[model samples]
Target: MTQNIGDALENSTSQASLAHSRKISEKIEQAIKEDATQFRVLTGDRPTGNLHIGHYFGSLQNRLRLQEAGVDTWVLVADYQVITDRDGVGPIKDRVYSLVTDYLALGIDPKRSTIFAHSQVPALNQLMLPFLSLVTDAELRRNPTVKSELEATDGRPMSGLMLTYPVHQAADILFCKANLVPVGKDQLPHLEQARVITDRFDARYGRPKGSDKRVFPRPQGLLSNAEMVLGLDGTKMSKSKGNTIELRMSADETAKLIKKAVTDSDRHISFDPVNRPEVANLLTLISLCTGQPQVEIADEIGDGGGGTLKKMLTEALNEHLAPFRARRAELEANPGYIVEVLHEGIARANAQADATLAEVRSAMNMVY
Candidate 1:
């Protein structure tokens, strides 16, 4: 089987990471075949804004699959992380609840998946202390996520939280011993750091060599199957850029947005992301909605022009999202249920985190 396994590990372009990605990709397949119940997955979203199609295609869809496969899945609403790079955390409480609503509406069954708020889980955050000690300041600066976030902030001095954002994420994963983290190519580095932290702690503090007491599982990045989901303007889909379609937008709102999506003057629709990115993005969105091959969709819309392509997308996408909208409306009507779900998740997360922390302390001989 020829594998461009290189792409799955696009976490790093180096030969080593490519080789490692191939091995993990195969392990992921085997893990699904084995007793999946033995594996736990930790995935999350920072409640910065409403989730967009990029999120759906990028990670959430895979999350739903993992949930259905009977794997233990936990979705963290990283409420505190929202303040990492930003100055003022905007309507965070609302966004956090809205995130839970989106998850429920999108079929993330709380009964199966533990959906928790980071701020509500104290024990989990407690793991950050020992984790912080395990990582060096030089290592923190070397993190690509830290560098990228720093670059995003125009020369402003970064906060201590921002400097150690990656370790916080490592804490998120290790606190629960989550072995699989669904991530995009851009997030591979963050997952790598979590693995590094788990290994470091295990080495320095874990039980003896012959009878090693592994307190944390080295998490692996389960690469998303979707390509880089672009915005209507053919740029990275971003809420800040206003180029995204939020998951909660009504059908009419979605149609209005798609109507304004960028496209070329060519009447013939085709999938050529290289030279005709805008047209290709529209086609890709349509394919994602209808689950048809992009080339086939483009051929089906040949010579129909951008208007016809957008029309098809608006229709397909609205139909696809209609059920989610209905579900969300019902969930919105009962805000209590949303809070109940979050509270339950926090309880479960606290239990797991406390257990891990207790064991970690014992391993490090810090129980005293």
Candidate 2:
């Protein structure tokens, strides 16, 4: 009788676990459907150089997904935020246009998604004034992304703009009244700071105690499932590190880079990121491109060694990126098209930003 009770208890626990998992899965499906049909998504990049596959897997692909879902998408070319650490802006105009061209080549429709230069949006900058006042210095100093960036600059003196760029980000989001900010885990802290500022601003100058409407909706982070794409050297893919596969690289260049990528000497192929990060990173990259499981990729390669893996990766990447390169080449031919896209995006962005800024000023009684 005691044995029967034990078996019954175990069965009950298993059933409960399965039920819970089903509930969670249902919620996730619902969220994905909702995101596809309705949401305001804000996501962008700082154009320091040509974007790598890391940028694509990390954010750009997700942006395209949402845009296709009919979600209101806004992509910012954060030009103003680029000078926080660097001294002189090197060919910033070319970089900005390159970034826009890449966006167009990747299927980010200028009509469906508003893509604009951050520096050109005056209302976004104006919104920063009050937002700056809402956060404390200590809070700025504590931002993890800021700390990592400062460290990357190797103990350089912290610039004021660098410290308060999180506030600038808040303005970027709120100026467009963004309710969903797609981000990686590393960026959660920045979005959290944005939320804190939004709450404080709403309390200070939002609708009266009895009113229902509020000025700014506290934005939430839509955390990405994608992992941090490692560079050829098994570190972060960085332009400075010279270990990135740029999105626009030709097939030969990509093949050369993959050939030179660091990998282990072990004859066996396996996905062990901790022990064989180089090999595992390659497999991860392949999986991302091919939509195949890493285990399957490893099994297929099966003791063919790193050389076999690199060859496979090279072919996969070149094949995958061919369309993107062709599209970008076409866009490059008509440089005026890139300029026109930016101008149209800027006009649309300014109109939306101005409307939001007017509401903000009125709420703060700055409408004299």
Candidate 3:
């Protein structure tokens, strides 16, 4: 409530975006009078595992709204980053396909937007060279997300590919010349890096009297307002944590998971997340799924103990997931539809990436 709700909501529209939800909140608070319709948006996800409720509520749902709102949307699979961060790539193809299935199930029509894999379009990575030259090693080391990731991996830095992940992301956004990037609070630094790089590039080659040619636009953060949906264990809802509720989970599985969700022993059903993280998380999930306010939901469960709350949450979650499950089943049966959709996205995305790469090459005088 203390933050800018508008920017937060916009950032929630793109959690994986470079701008944090909090930054977006402030920007929106400041720019309340301007029309946002002219903006082109870019955001994406890593295909590390199955899509979950956190992703849906935090980002994908917002993407659907953006699409309907007439914003030009570009959603990338981020397959290349996934490979850079982790080791084994055995089931990479399956995960990418599953991600594609998620887009279709969530109503991300390929005809209305561009959706593509990071690896399929090779040109995007090439921009990394020029983009990287704009920043120093210390700058990369200072990035919070990058530092957190490196620390999380126990100081085991991956290959050069992983080290330069931010540049790749810059290429992703600059390729489309996006004006808006919907991201969560944690990713703001990356976007800032992109902004700095864009500015540097423009300054060096921008079209002034007796000046060079400009190639990119510095995009602003759209910041999402989505609250973090915690997993069963009160941590972020991630598949790696084994605490996520899969987007395509069956009604029975959802009920069972809700029932098993960690909650306090307190007999009261309240919205006190500080003391009652487990119960509060369940309430949060239910509220997100049911479109009911947390206080209203807490009032409904009033001191009935964990079982009653769990039961209520189970019912709400299952009911909420009914439509998505149905859609997922239909999409899963016709695997070719998913492939075709991605192929179409890949083609469209390639055109955009190719053009951006051409401009970069021309600006640097790389052409023969």
Candidate 4:
């Protein structure tokens, strides 16, 4: 009887998993059918450092697609969120500039997308107060992304700001009235919280169904199709790990880094990530940049071993990044160009954020 009960539980769990997957598929199909112009997408990165290839494939490239699809895209620098864990702001100014430059070089047209620093938008900050009341401390701590991030800090005590990171993100989404957010599977929980907060606020303060006073739109996650790009060490690509290839790195720098990448002694070239992570990582990088299948890459590098594979990867990477590097160099030479772009973004963002905040204040009866 005990074994029978366990089998039944396993079947039920499997069924639930199938249902969830079907639901996600339906959402993706619906999103594909929707008019892109109707989507106001809010997505961004923290200006902690230079973006890596992982960032390029994972989010930046998708942002370009969405922008070109006629979607109104807002890319936030999220500079304010940097203090949640770090003790002091280290080279934030330079990093912010680099982040914007990376975006532009990679095809985020400033005219088509609004790219602004988080700290520069005071109205977004103001929305946090009312938003805080809508979420609980327990809910904040339960977020998987927050939990994983804190765990990565090696037992560092959580800060108040860190605990409330999801709420702040909610403000970022709603302030712009964005109806879509681009995220990976791991970030779904963060987007879920944003949706929950929107529902609660709408229920509590929104007008009748027919009224025009509806404030926040429930933001939906537009899951990215890009596969996760692992670092040369076969771990998540991170700047702190010293394994990432930064977008700003020259061809020589990239080649030098790839040459030192870890790989196994297996005489055969294959794409088995389980046993041959290093080789698989190299293949994944090649496939992403070259638009080739991993199986094809494995076939091409047959029996040539890790040395030949690394050389091929280095060549492919240089070819892939050459245009981006040239464009970045041209933009970097005119440092004032970045400043002007940020200022324009700030102005546009402020106008939208201020309007949203005023509506929130009026809804909460805080406007005197």
Candidate 5:
């Protein structure tokens, strides 16, 4: 059971907090608009499993927006991070290829964005050593997201890698000095830790005596406006649960999944998320897909029972995902092309990461 990054933030959310996040998002957008080249976005998932609808709506869409806006995008497969909680690494390269296809299917242009596997960048991982020294064990233990994930591990002994996840995440963002990260509220703490590391490291060394610039810019969290998309069972969509509508699923497979969705017996459906979450979850999906409000969709499907609701959702979802599916099919067939994409991305990442590492070494007076 993979725990979400922000299980602790559930209790901390409020209108005021959301408003603050939105304000920050607006500031970043304006900054990017003024000078897109001055900003870079670091976003991608660990090669855990097939990315589901939850990923698409939650994070993928925002990354696309940033790329389309001409911001430099660095997408990391985070291959090493997969070993954090598990004894087995599983088929990481395969997962990375799947994730890349999902990205391509969903509009991640390799030409416009650099996508690379974590293990391919040695200089990037090397950052972990100095970064580890910058933070205390107490500080690492204090991260709320880390705490939640530890609990999610179901009492398995926490590995050192797991404990240092936030630091590793910091390496991902700072290795290339990405100034903006697409994150939800739960990940704010993770981003904050990266900022902390950047601040401390910059103050300690590496800015070049009078270059008038810090070694690394403290990256900001680009808070998302996406909603929490529930799975068929009215719970958070997760790959482990087999409740997700994965981007790679066939149209028929998607329809079958929706058909099995748990909806209430109430023939008269309304968008009452707090009361009838299962049906409301279906409404939410339809709304996200069709760009129509949940209430309106519920009204249209009123008294039609769960069957009609599922049917509507099936059509809307499939129609919305057809292009992505078509592109994914072609990409899946062209395995060689995917390798080329990964190779190009890895080469680009190597140059960027090597430069960053050189600066870090020089700053710490360890440039032997």
Candidate 6:
């Protein structure tokens, strides 16, 4: 009887686990759908260099999906933010336009999405002056992303702009009255700051018809399902590190980069990230591109050795990226069309920013 009871309990536990997994999946799909309604969404790249596949799967894909779902999307070319982490802006001056070209290459249709240079929207930054005082230095210090960035500088004193990047991000979101900000878990703190500042402003100024005031909707961070993709070297895939595969690269270039990627000395192709980070990382990259689950991919590649794994991964990545590469080439062939799209996106984004700024100014009693 005791053995029978144990079997029953095990079966019950297994069923419960299956139910929980299904529930979580449903919740995620529901959240994505829920967040897609009557919403203004803001997302962008820092434009440090050409974006890699990591950028596409991590954030850009989600942005594209949101736009397709009819969410009002704004893609910011974060030119100023790049200067926060780097020493010079010479390459950026040249590369920013390329970023827009790549955006056009991707499926970010300017007809539906707003794409613009961050610096051009001066009115957005104007809100930062009043919003800055609402948050604390300790709060900024506590932001994980901020700490990681500052630590990378070996404790070098940061610029005022660098220190207040979170606040600037807040202004970017609230300036468009964006209710949905798609971010990874790492960026949650900055979104929290946006919420805090919005609440503080509304509380201080928002009254009634004949009374006080309120303006911005405290934007929520619609967390991304995507995980942070590490580079070939098992570090963050960054252009400066020379570890990235640019989205605009040819199939030959993609294969070369993958072939050279670091993997374990062992011959076996197993997916044990904790024990073998290099092989596991490669496996994850392939899985991401192919939409296959990590475990299933590991099983299929089953002890095939590094050479075999690399070849398979190379094929998978190229196959997945070929369409985008072709599109990018076609788009690059016509610089005029790219320019028109960017200008049109800027006009739309500026209109939204201007309207939101007006509401903010009115709420703050800055204007009679």
Which of the numbered candidates is closest to the native, going by highest lDDT? 5
lDDT of 2 at 111: 86
Q: Give TM per candidate.
A: 0.94, 0.89, 0.88, 0.91, 0.94, 0.86
Misplaced by over 4 Å in model 5 are 1-19, 152-155
Task: Judge candidate 4 at residue 121 and give its lDDT.
Answer: 91
Better of 4 and 5 by TM-score: 5
lDDT for each residue of candidate 1 in 284-347, tens digit (9 for 90 to 100): 8888888899999989988999999999999999999999999999999999999999999999
Give each model's clash number. Answer: 0, 0, 14, 0, 0, 6
Model 1 root-mean-square deviation: 4.4
Candidate 4 whole-model C-alpha lDDT, 0 to 1:
0.83
Q: Candidate 6 lDDT (Cα, whole model)?
A: 0.77
lDDT, residue 2, candidate 6: 12
Clashes of 1: 0
Candidate 6 global Cα RMSD: 9.2
**How do the residues 106-149 of candidate 4 rate in per-residue lDDT, one tens digit apiece?**
99999999999979999999889878877766567667656677
The C-alpha lDDT values of all candidates are: 0.85, 0.83, 0.78, 0.83, 0.87, 0.77
Residue-level lDDT tens digits of model 3 in 233-304? 888777878897888788888888877788888887899888877788888888987889987889988889
lDDT of 3 at 201: 72
Runs of candidate 1 with Cα error greater than 4 angstroms are 1-16, 208-211
Worst lDDT 10-window in candidate 4: 1-10
